[model samples]
Target: MKTKVNEISIKYQGNFKISQAPKISSSVNAAELLYNTWNKDQIGLQETFKVVLLNNANKVKGIFEVSTGGITGTLVDLRILFAVILKSLSCSVILAHYVK
Candidate 1:
């Protein structure tokens, strides 16, 4: 008899076309992109960590929030971080954190 097992799947979805995604050539470009995507209301209230997922061409795949915490700090799990990068099939990544 075969035992029941859980099946796992990973997916990445983007609302916009890849060609329309902005390309990142410099740290400034990435900061601008991340800044634009950040939630303005939460910028000062808490600490949050995010990852900017990029394609081989350095175009954005998406931004994934790794964790959120109190005003002072947040935690980032390497396992979860890698899982998101692997699942999204990102070629490279930029890490960002916000703190007031």
Candidate 2:
């Protein structure tokens, strides 16, 4: 059997960054911020969660999905988050959200 690496093509849009948002110094940073915020929005959803690791430049080094759960499910583990960051050399991490 042969295994292939999957590439998740990240889409970029001018709108991905907001010019009016003075908090971000650059568009790339802004998009990364939003990507992280939305990714971790666990409200009104199942237990599905994602973790986005960013390099020192704030570029997305990797995006990992730990678990996909439901309202009645147990909480997700924090070790998963640490594991991803530990293996990879990420400057920072942003939690997308947990399903519950």
Q: What is the TM-score of each candidate against the true structure?
A: 0.88, 0.50
The global C-alpha lDDT for each of the candidates, from Candidate 1 onward, is: 0.90, 0.59
lDDT of model 1 at position 31: 87
Per-model RMSD to reference: 1.7, 7.6
lDDT of 1 by residue, 5-92 (tens): 9865555576789999999999999989989988999899999999999999999888889999998889999999998898788999
Model 2 lDDT, full chain set: 0.59
Candidate 2, residues 1-100, lDDT tens digits: the string is 9999975334333354432333434657655664555544565565566766666656655566666677766456877667667777668776655433
Give the 10-residue window scoring lowest on summed lDDT in candidate 2: 16-25
